[model samples]
Target: MANPKRKWSKARTARARSNWKLSVPGLVECPQCHTKKMPHKVCKTCGYYNGKVVVQSEEQD
Candidate 1:
């Protein structure tokens, strides 16, 4: 195995990690309740997916 010849500088390390950020989750409006949710996933608010009730949420009880 090979090792690095020199230690990386703090600024350089910071610059490299600057782009290592968490991106906001992609959310789209739920067709059933019109609330924001992840695309193609069941809506946590309504427990629905693709216009069908995949999960029986608390509100539905």
Candidate 2:
């Protein structure tokens, strides 16, 4: 078995991790209810997706 001849440096490791990041979820407004939701997904507030009801949302108290 062969082992690594050179140890990985901190700068090199950090540079590789520079692009590793968490990105915010993509969201869009529902045309029917004007609520923010994930693209192509049903709006939880109004239960509509692409002009069709996909879920029954409960009334907010």
Best by TM-score: 1
* TM-scores of the candidates in the order shown: 0.67, 0.62
Backbone clash tally (model 1): 0
lDDT (0 to 1) per candidate: 0.87, 0.80
Clashing pairs in 2: none
Tens-digit lDDT track for model 2 on 18-43? 86776777889889988788897778
Q: Which TM-score value belongs to model 2?
A: 0.62
**Model 2: number of backbone collisions:** 0
